[model samples]
Structures are given as structure tokens and as C-alpha cells.
Target: MSTPDPDPDCPSTPTTTGTETYLSGGCHCGANTYQLTLPAQPSPPFPLVDFDHCTSCRRTSGALLQAWIILPQSWAVFHISSTFDQSHTVYASSVVTAGALRKELGGGEPKSLVHYASSPGVSRAFCARCGTHLVYSRVYEEREAGDGPEGEGDGEDFVGVSLASLDKDSLERAPRPLQHTWWGDGVPWLKEMIAKGCEEGGIGAMEKLEGYQ
Candidate 1:
């Protein structure tokens, strides 16, 4: 899929109408700087959500489940020019699955997201500098129009970034609904949160992790 052109009309400064708010953050070294605009009311405290059974996420985070959030690519405005200079690395665990989908269904290769290999074509991306887990993109076999190659293919273009790793104030700005993923691979401890009906993207878990990190 073609990337939307940087809106020439896109404002240099993001707009805030009280409905939407903007947040800024970067890696520990400040190399991978970025800004995102999201709804401000119920801010997402924890950026990490469970990718329950995703193998790649397990390997990358060294945890049973991978947690992430989907943000509009437009919300992500980066200062660095290239991911390479910023110390980006790519994993090819699931490239074959991605490649196959592109060939048969015509979905383009994954974009600037990070990659981690659980197996071929089954990689996940995270911030190289600070280890902030990002999005999980893979190639699945099903190819129904508008779902796979033809349509957005489960919203592949939607980029997921780790909320735990972002700057604190920024995390408080653009709150989002927590989303559960790959439940089959989820760890047992997460069930406690589910029992309490914890919201998906809330920062409760992230704060606890910060004490250890």
C-alpha cells in the first residue's frame, strides 16, 4: 500500500481542540524522538498490552505476551531522518509470510516498524535504543479482499508503540482503550488484571515495571 503523502497542508504544530491532545517522547538517548496526537480525556497510562500468543513478541520482550497500542501514523512525527542512523535493526522471522502475502495478495512490504524473529516472516518491531516494544506485523495465509492484500489486512498500517517507554507526561496525554491480543499466548499473571476488569492501555502495570527497570 502507498503511504499517505506527508500532508503538505499538515500543520507544523498539531492541533488541540480539547477533543484531541498531542504528546511527545523519545528514546533514552533522545535519538528516536516522536510526537503523537490522541484523545486526551481518558489517557492511556500503560502503553503495554498483551499480545497473548504471538511467538515473536514473546522472544522480543522476553515475556509470554506482547503488549502494544495502535496509533494513527499521522500522530507519529519523528525528528530523526533514518532508522539506521538511529540504530534500528530488522528481524526476518516472518518475512516469508510477509513476502507471500505481498506476492499473492499484493500487500506491500511492512514499513519503518521494528522487527524481531520468532520464525521466518514472524517478526516484531521495537525502539532499538531503549527497547520500547513497538508494532507486530506478520503475513497470515488468508487473503480475502478488503481483509488481507486487497483491504487494509487487519489494519497493518496502524502502528503500535510501547506506552511504558514513552515520556511520562506524554503517556498521560493521549489515552487509548487497552486492546488484548493473541490471548492464546498470554501469560498467567495477566489474568489478574482481567479479573479486575482493568482497562487495556492504562499505565498501571508500566509504573510497576519502572521500579524494577
Candidate 2:
């Protein structure tokens, strides 16, 4: 599938409240959902988004180009389902090391989100029902458990949320993506499509929007 222009209705508007910012997103089938929070700052990077033109992303997501939002694992919380109504515990260490986690939610697995090992240490998560690519995660440490550092993964675990899965309101309120990655792998028409999308359906009009100006 080709990466078509973003819907004009989702104008990339990004929202803010006292001392914090938030963006809501999910899959096409409402099977995967999440809320991303950005701590208050002098200037908020509400949408630290990236457009990925990598072959892996394109083939897996079936889109011409994949747009992803970069977030630190510790900086965001995720909930599954159409509505953000579920709960779980995060184990920076092993859940077994902590008592509260065992009783707080289901077994210690990424709920409902099926993951595929896209590479040796990279996992690509997607919705089992709708096939919407949710998040791409990469492991930082590869040594066997108890053999490497105290933790199974290095502190550098990363998360990349699919930007196209965001809600219309969140999309409209979101900041423009930071930049395009793997642009060289994209088709020759990719740049023209982006420019056209910006002019017609993307964040090009955002600067003129109220408050943003």
C-alpha cells in the first residue's frame, strides 16, 4: 500500500494543559490504545514525530511511509482497548522483584499486543485483530539473563509509536513530525507527496491556526 495523504480533518493541532501535554492514539480496530504524556517544559515537543521510509516499516505496515513518534519508555504510559480503561504495572526491574505488580494486573506480558521480532533485538508490535502496527521496541542488551548487567535489557530500551494511529483530535493538535528518516529508500515521488500533503492535508496550515500563531 502507498502512504496516502493524511486526512485533512486531522490538522496536527496538539493540546496542552497546566504543566503537561497529552496525545491519544490507537489502532484501526480499537484493539490497541495508549496515552502519551509530555512533562511541562519551556517549549513542549508534543509531537516529536518521524516519518520512516524504511523497507521494514513499509512492508510491515503496508504503508508507503510510516510516521512514528519517539518517546522514552519511562516517559509514557500505555493502556490497551478502544477506550483507555485498562491498567497494568510497569517493572523497570523484573515484576517478580516487586510485590505490587503481581497483584495489580494480568501476567507480565504486553497485553493483547502481539509482537514480531523484526530483527535480532527489535520487536514490532501490532494489533492481532486489525493488523495495525502499534509500537516498535528495541532491546539494548543481548547477554543472557543473569549473565549480563543486573537487568535483562540495557537502560536504553526504545519505543516508537505509530503516528498514523493517533486520534483525529490528537492528530490535529499534534506538532509536526521532527523529520523523515530513511528518506533515501522512499520512492522518487515521496518528497512531492509530502509537500503536497503539507500544503493540503498536513501541518502546513498549523502555523496559521489560532494560538499556534
Candidate 3:
């Protein structure tokens, strides 16, 4: 997919409150639904962006890396009351040392954050039925233990959801992605574009290799 253009007049500061545009999206099965409120201009700490070269994300989405939009934990809403069957099948890709992956995957953990082994401490959640990826979270060790990999105190919670899986037109007015990450795992041609600061394809090369896979 082509990257969307960034708003020229967008601002860099974060907003505490305003009449922002709200958009909604859900899974193909409609089991998972979410709503996001975007600023009229570029808001620092805006929710979504593209992630590149994340191994678990690449495998899960079958794409170079998943597009992640961050939603305010307060503003984001999930409704699985009626679709529990579809919602329950969601899988946790890696093993957790403290608890069962399923238990660690859900809410209510003191310092829980979904994690993928490739990106340790980074947690990812996805649909169990159609395999639609949902969100990713990470532990907040800074506030918890003063300084440590494993947290000891209460940590802030965060999630990154796949923009493509959202309901239609939800991101119609959102800002374009701002950065690319994990470029090391990105295919060679893609790496070249990054080196040259070009925003176009390495897709043709990827396509050529598809037949072999």
C-alpha cells in the first residue's frame, strides 16, 4: 500500500482535550471493535504508525511489519460481550514466565504487557477466529522499579493496534506514518530505499521471491 501524505500544517504538541475526529473499526468477523479520536492536526503521541521488521509482526500479518496506531487507553473501547466465542480464541504468540500465556494476555495483571520473543517484553494480541491482529503492549519498567528489566511496581499500559484491521474509513483523516523500525529485518531492496531516503518500493523484488516460498 502507498503511504499517505502528511499534513503540512500539522503541529508538534500534544493536546489534552479538544473536539477531535473519532473513527471506528473492527475485525472481519466483527468480534473486535475499536474507536480512535484523532487530532485535527498532527498531535504528538498520536496513536498510529507503521512498524517495519518486527519478526512476530511480519509473520502474523504476512506483511513487512504491521501498521500500529496508538489509541488512548481511556479512549479505546472493546466490546466482546456478545462475541466472546470469537474473541476467546485469540492467541498469545510467545510463552510468559510468570503465568500461562492466556492469563498474561488478558487484562488485570499488575505489570502485564503482551510480548513477542523476537521483541522481548513487547506483547501482541490477535483475533483467534480469522487471525486478525489486534494490539501490542509493552511493560513500563522505568516507573516500576527505578531501574530493571522486570518491573516491580505498577507500570503504565499501552497498546498498538493494526490499522488495516480497523473498520472502514476509520483512518480517513489520520496522519501518515512517521517512521520505520527494525529495518535490519526488512528485505534488501527495502533497505536500499531507506538508505537512499526514497519512499517507494522494494516490493517488486519481494514479489519475485514469492514464487519460491
Candidate 4:
């Protein structure tokens, strides 16, 4: 069966927008740098934002909450460099698909980028030099309901970037996470804090320790 046409208004498709904005970011040690092209006011969540509470995400990131932004791989341009510095060159200039980008990077261009299989068919990328968690990806299989063939399924590759990896300006420009994922895997207190914070008005609901103000 053929794949369905992509939705033009979907947040995943940045090319549908009239105006474009670029967000530049990289790992802490600058080993991996990328620029994400987004719509001026990208849909509701052009760069789809969310908080991942999965145990794997928490353990890999070593953070209480792991924030991520999802987008099509075609929207991102990666900069590869032998030296992690301001001067880096773009390796793959053409638009790359989600699966293609993973393969290209996995070939070891920068030599600092490393990939780990967090679970079967689930991969996570990080900077070996800086130890900064960078990306999480998963392969999803969709089997159309029909009597075509046994175990026949189409695979979709998705990529999610670490929100904290974005530059200061990009982080400020990015939208706030709209939802929580893997809530069951989250710490109880952290979940309560989020619930209460939403119930009240923002961070004001949380306890402000000494020198916090």
C-alpha cells in the first residue's frame, strides 16, 4: 500500500509556512551542531514540545525532567567538525530524511557523536566528548489492516532533540512544553509539583527556598 499524503498544515511540515525562522543549537562541547528551520509562528507547536518522563529518558539524561522537541529531519541541518569550535562545516547540504540522517551520522563524521540503543528499535544519540544527551529516536511499524502478506508493515522513523541542548536564544524563542509523556514513569513529587503549578498560576505555586527569590 502507498503512503498517505503529508498534511500541509501539520506542525511537522515547516515548508508549508510563509515565513521561516532558524534555531541554532548543539551539544555542550560543540561537537554536534544543528540548525532547525521553523515557521515564524510555527503552527500550534511547529517544533513539537513535550516533557518525557520515561525511565530511559531520565536515566540517559540524568535529569528529573527531560524535555524534547519533535520535528521532521528535513528541517534540520547538521554541522560536522573535526574540532569542536565555532568554525564547523556542513556535512550533508541536501535535505535528509529521518532515516538517512541517522545513517549518515552513525557513519562517524565528527567522531564525537555516539549512538546507543536504549531499547530494541529505540536509539539515542549523544556527544562522547561532552557527555551531553542529544537525540532520541524510535522505529515504529505500522501494519495496514488487509490480507496482503504476513508480517508486512511500514516502518516510520522519528527523531526528538533534547530541549536543553538548544542555544540560549533558541531556547527563549522555543515554545513551552504543552504535555507530559510517560507520566507513570515520573517521580511522584515531580508530578505533583507540575499538577499544583498548573492548578495555581505557574512556578509561584512551588515552594521558594531561601535565596530562591
Candidate 5:
């Protein structure tokens, strides 16, 4: 499904607050969309950004490296495209609070949104039709022994949004990777390549391509 031109009633522009900046993103097919409110500087560490290389993340995303921008559940709002015509016209859309979205995944509300446990207690949400991985989340009981991947279950009542799903402008404005997660699980060659890229003169000294000499 494709998102039609934004109806005045459904403005797609990003907004901001005194201390927060808003960014928007969605699935490739535009079946699902969300807004993320982040701090202008830094706060509760909610808007945490990091690169992940765990086996589960690699397998689930089919990518060598994955980046996640995490925040509190209350900091996001999701829009589900519900009504449309044969011409791919979006006639009606509904807003789903992050809490409600979490509770209704794979059940009701936001029919296009679905999720599955990539591992015990950890659910990954994606678009049913476009297959765009959107959110990662897990809940824990008080004093419960929550153990899994390096970055999973480290926080409470938080959801991690895939950096890959952010829109162009938002992605460009997203924060830099704060750290590397599950570094040991990364492929050896890929790790070497990344290390080289980080070295002072390594990237520029490597073979030049297309536009560069």
C-alpha cells in the first residue's frame, strides 16, 4: 500500500517542542508510520542510539549490522492506515498510542502491524504487508532474571525503533551510533572492514570507486 499525498487533516510535517525534536518514519509501503520525540540535548538516556551485531539481529534483519534508536514507550505515537480505495488512496487513518500498539500487536487494532518473539520475552514488530521491521521490545517482571542478547532487556518499558525504518530526513538527522552492541558476534571480515573505516587514514587510502578518483 502507498501513502497518498498528505491530507491537510493528516499533516506529515515534523514538529518540535522547547526541549524536544520530533522525527517521523514508516514502512516502505507506507502502511504504517510513527513519530518519535527526542530530547534536544540528552535526557533519561531514552533516545539511546547504538549499532548492533548480535546473531539474532543479523538473522532477523538480514543485515550484517543493525542500528537502533531507543526511547520510552510514551515518546512515540503510531498511525495505522486503515481505509483506502482501489487507487491506493488513503481515506482514513487512526492514531495508536505506543502502549496500545504494544498490547494489540498480533491481536487487534493496527491490522497491518504484527509481531513475533524473536526470542523468549522479546517481541519484534513489523508491517504485515511490507515486512518492514519497525520496533523491538521486551517486558520484565520485578526482580525477574531477564537475560538474552547484549542490548535486550537492559531497560524497562522502552521500545527500540529500527534506524533503517526512519524516513530520509529523520535518518539524516538521527544521532550518531553511541556504542557497539554484541561486537563479539559480528563477522570477522565485517569487523575488520569497520575497524579500517574508523582508522584515521584507512578509508581514504582504500581503493577509490565510482566518483572518487
Candidate 6:
């Protein structure tokens, strides 16, 4: 079957339980740093961290596997690392929804960011200096044909970032992922890694999808 058309305005249900906590994280060089405000208990339709095996994610990160921490833009907090000083460059998109709320973007790219336009409308931001994978995001371009942003994202989609960038405090608090995607393009080594994760006490037990483990 052909892939379905992507709904730019994917529905999003923001139900912060009022027990949210803050988690801090940065890159290996400390040049890229940010914070994530996560709910104490994860709401439905989203988990703390999810693994992606799509060819894009794998190729961009130079590995067979990559993971993303899903959090709404309203809930995901950005910060500035002292090391960047005053040279952080902003990588903004044509998406008008995020224009006014650019302040809420993850981390202050004061010193300029290395932005990779992974696809036509999808963008992946990373640290220009330390080369840290930051956010995997898509623009919800408001088109005249849509019905007031009622799709899966609801106009305020979560900024996808590397789960490894989240602080340990957040990691401990993160719930185990229950599902994954993009298996139509199967791989060999990743399956081995998944089986190893099951044996070595990683994110496993997600056998609902065959051939992943």
C-alpha cells in the first residue's frame, strides 16, 4: 500500500496533570544545553521516549537506531548554554504557528545552529559546535484547505529531540516505550540490536510487532 498523505495538523491532546517536573540536558561538549518540562505521569497517546528506525533517522544519526523524546512545544522548555555566550543563531521555519512561540523552542541557538532539512517540510536541529542531535520537528503549515487545526497534532506538536540528551532525572522518570514505527523498510543489524536490548535489559518486550526483535 502507498503511504498515506501526512496531515500537517496532527491532533494533540495537552493534558498536563499539574505534576510536571523539569529535566535538564545538553550535548557532550556542554555547548548545547536545554531543559524539558515533563508531566510526572505521561498522558495517553505519547510515551517518554520512542525509538525510530526510519531510514532518515538512521542515516542522519549514522546508526541503525535513533530515539525521540516526545513533548508538546508548550511543555518542552528551551534553554541557553553559558558556553555559547551571545552567538546562538536561530533556525526558524516558515511555519507561522511557531513564529510567535519561538521563545519556547528547545535551547537558545545563540551561536547559530546546524539545521538539516531532512525532508520537504521536516527539519532536524542540532548543535553546530558539539554536533549534538537536538530536535526532530515538522512544520504545521496552515493551509486554506484544513478545518482549523484539528488533525493529529492539533497545531501544537511536540518537538522531537534525542532522548539521550535528556538528563538522568528525566531518564529515570521516563516510562518505557511500548511501540515503535517504520518497519516496512526492514534491516538486519537493528533486529540483532533489538534482541540484544531485550537480553541486556534495555527497552524490550515490544513484541507486538514481529521481526523487530
Cα misplacement distance, residue 10 of candidate 4 (Å): 26
**Per-residue lDDT for 70-176 in model 6, tens only?**
66666554433323432333232222222223333344534424567787656777766667777776666732335212234555555676877665566665555
Candidate 4 vs candidate 6: which has greater lDDT?
A: 4
Model 2 lDDT per residue over 1-213, tens place: 332233232223456889877777766655445666666772223335788888899999998889887655554455443222223221121211111211222335444456687767667777655678888765556423543112224454446778888877887766577777788887666666667776755445334646644
Best by lDDT: 5
Tell me how many clashing residue pairs each candidate has: 26, 6, 10, 0, 0, 20
Worst 10 residues of 1 by lDDT: 92-101
What digit string (tens of lDDT, one per residue) describes model 3 on residues 26-137?
Answer: 5555444555556557334545475556566788777865677764344454433222332333222232322133354465532213334336565666544445666665
Off by over 4 Å in 4: 1-18, 40-46, 83-99, 108-110, 140-156, 198-213
lDDT of 3 at 138: 56
Error of 2 at 88 (Å): 21
What are the clashing pairs of model 3? Answer: 25-167, 26-167, 47-69, 47-70, 48-69, 48-70, 114-122, 114-123, 115-122, 115-123
Candidate that would win on TM-score: 5
* Tens-digit lDDT track of model 5 for 1-213: 555454443345666779988888887767678888887776546577889989988888888888999877778888876654456455667787676676767564437678888876688888776788888876655224555333445555677889888877788777878888889999887777778785655544566579856
Off by over 4 Å in 2: 1-15, 42-47, 81-111, 142-154, 192-213
Question: How high is the lDDT of residue 82 in model 5?
Answer: 68
Distance from true location, Cα of 35 in model 1, Å: 1.2
TM-score for every candidate vs. truth?
0.50, 0.62, 0.58, 0.69, 0.80, 0.64
lDDT of 4 by residue, 1-213 (tens): 222222121222222235886666777655566667776665433467889898989999999999998765556665544444333322332334445656756674455567798777677888766778988766554323442112322333446879898877778877688888889999987887777675664444656688957
Better of 3 and 6 by TM-score: 6
Overlapping backbone residue pairs in candidate 4 total: 0
